[model samples]
Target: MVAFPDPNHAVRIAANELRIAWRTLRGKSTAQLASVGIVVVFGAAFTAAAAYGAYLGGRGLAENPGELSQLVSLVPAGLATITLFMAAYLTVVQLGDIDVRDGYLTTVPARDVVGGLLLSGYVRAAGLFTAPLLVASAAFAVGAGSPLAFPLAALAVLALTATAFLVGFPIGVGIAYLASRSAIVARFKTLIGAAAFLAYFGLIVSGTFDEAIDPILGVAQASPVSWYADLAVLAVVPSASAAKAGVVLAGSVVLGAGGVLASVRLSERRWYTESVEASERETDSVSSGRLDRLVGRRPAWVARKSWLRARRAPIKLVFVAYPAFLLVTPVQASVEAGHVTSSLPPSIALYGAWMTGAAFTLNPLGDEGAVLPVTAISGISGRDFVGGLVVASAVFGVPLTVAVAGGLAVLSPLPPVALACTVVAAAVLPVLAAALAAGVGTTYPKYDATSISRSREVVVPSMWAFGVYTLAFLLTAGIATAVQVPAAAGALANLLGVADAAVHVGALAVGVLLAGILATVSVRIAVRAFDDYTA
Candidate 1:
């Protein structure tokens, strides 16, 4: 007879979990981590600046001796909120231990298996965020001017990190399971995700960062994150009690351990319970609805069809929203500086338009999923099929592009005529982007399973499609911006014996002309690709 060890053997279970987590992380890390490098690099730079500022902050403390101490006290609260939210949100999006649950339940007790998952979450959470945190803290310490700041900063970070993982792991794990087990949650999750994303975007748009106070004494001086600040003070200033730091450190560990056990128990109870099987069901169809009623202001039918298709899936909209994030920093800067700048308006408009087209128009036929072959064999002409896709994008893309760019331009300090020129460029350029994206995307179509979330698969646009569209849009936006700029177009206007206004208008005319040509050619290419495909 084979002997089996007690399932609740914490050490063994934790070790197994850690090993599996490491293997999982390593296996697909190349592609995922490759994309994460941009964020990592940006974080490193941000941390370096913070560290330099910390040195200055330390100096300020000599003048106001109590300031740093007061500031350190509130760090824990801020950390608490951040850890709670990120851990929970990420948990909902990424975590799903159902498969592991199925595998482990045959031998180990369910509680023990959950214990392992809890351990994995703890390890993964720390590993995921620690590098950036440590980098920033280390930099801050270097600038802090005392030899002791380095060690103190490390302690502070460790304490905060421990607290976060302890709290976040349980919440995240529980939420992940809830999302999996509950049909209502799974159904509404997309909208909730979009809302959460918009909230973050709202924060960036609000420009609340500009009204910053001194870091050592941030606005929240009485929060749990401040406990970490105390640890730092004890590290840098010998007069501070080691006993206090020891107490905080000990509390963090105890809390974490307790959280781990509670989380495992909670997960076992919920995950092992009877659950309903969830899946998608067909909804009422509206494809036959008239275009004018379905999509007002559009006398055309193609865009309306595209909208219906996108609304049904809506997964692609997430990718479409990528360009909007690019606006956050520039918009913040502009708000803080108290005026719209010429560059941001035109650029925002161009990205808006390009993304709109790419979102809907790029994968026209491929996005048809399994039904694509059927569409090809039908009586639909290439002009109607491809034209509808591009027009679908143009319908929303043109107005949105014009609104954002035109609004910004009007708000800018530029003369009225320049603003008018920008508005025109915004209207024309996206059509060009739509055309180019249509052609390029058709040329290099991607129709394969890609992970939208850890547990779900959907077909999104290819990397090549994104790259081609981005490069082309940048070049065209540059032309649009160049004409809008008073300086760049002044010499051209002089050379042609025309006013700057005429030159600007003429530049816009050129963009519109190019758009018309690109659209014609792109539609032709898409038509050819469709005609070549047989049912």
Candidate 2:
């Protein structure tokens, strides 16, 4: 017998969910909250300063009303751009909050769950966003010397911000839905999300978004969006037309408010009716023969399976996050200045090595999943399993590091000897990273497949393992950096009272020797751990 779902209780459920999300936010670590608060405060201050500047510029151009039209457009352009970014960020955050923690959602009607979650997320986001917008607008008005313009301008800003955010909500929800259900998208969604986020920051930092407003101003001149700006400007300059404000307010309420409500309603239905899990549509077609011929069958099978799992669900590549961090400088520089510095090569090479360590070696036991007991019983020796992982990491990490380092070396302004050292570090460092990954990760294997975005059953390395690996990687990277960069090498040689050539040689030798020794020791640890595990 099917029980019909009741949605009369949606608001009640949504209220409860909101309370829970509030508590979750409240329960966050002090450092985490402090960091977030600092970012918000900084952003608010910047916005306020910019708003004050715009007001000053507008006031300066008041004598030429025709010229002031471009200034009028800046008001909406600034607010709308910020609002869009905030909306996307909030949407991504909200999408991540979805849970399959329980099947109660199955019985309670999907609409109620979606409605409750959406409403809760929306309210929380609105509360967090509204304060900053209001604060910046109020600061602008005070600086404009028009305290009376505060109420009307603040009201219009709030309305437009809300409308823009609400409109963005559906777009985010749609992307999240596709990610959850489509295997192909689910595989690359993390990369896509990262790209989109970085691109936005890139455009903003480069002042490209500001330049984009010139063409857009033409379209917005007589639009309601422009009137929204007019209403904001009127708050500063009382001489500006108030009739534009009235029409905008009325139109915003009628159209924007209606759209916001309808979007939520439709999103609820769409999310509920269409929700599905992402699952593989095709299985791996890898043959074990080639690997079996190269290594033993057992080790080859394990390696093959590991590669397949990663290929099928690439979100499991959490270790890549370390390498990605190293890219921030180069990416930001390229976006801002249209080029990367010569110094980026060593950093990039070191990061490649770090990725190798952080990759496949972690969570060997946990990664076995339901097959752990069977695989253990089959008695695949610890050395072979660990050895297989090292081989797996080397296959990709080694070439990746060497190729990238060599390529970047061509672009570097380093002395020839330094370039040679860079190439050496790139070659040997990844192998060392792979070796350490096996031992440390085996010692602190993570089995509980925690949620990363929407991908399920994705096992990652334990925090302990990651910390130790990162510490070693950083030390090694520092050494590599010192040896591979001409300035750093010369300084180190002077400080250590050694020839520059000798210092470079010694550093490279030490890095390779250190990595090899650790990898050897780490692989042994992995073997011991693997042998000791009983099903």
Best by lDDT: 2
In terms of TM-score, which candidate is strongest? 2
Candidate 1 least-lDDT 10 residues: 1-10
- lDDT tens string, model 2, 32-129? 47866997788777667756764555454343434236656666655565565556566664532455525645667654555555455556665555
Cα lDDT, model 1, residue 69: 57
Q: Give residue 13's lDDT in candidate 1 (0 to 100).
A: 67
Supply the global lDDT for candidate 1: 0.67
Output the lDDT of residue 268, model 1: 69
Q: Candidate 2: RMSD over Cα atoms?
A: 5.5
Q: lDDT of candidate 2 vs native?
A: 0.68
Off by over 4 Å in 2: 1-10, 23-75, 85-118, 136-150, 174-223, 233-236, 261-286, 330-341, 365-375, 444-451, 454-459, 494-499
List all candidate RMSDs to the true structure. Answer: 6.0, 5.5
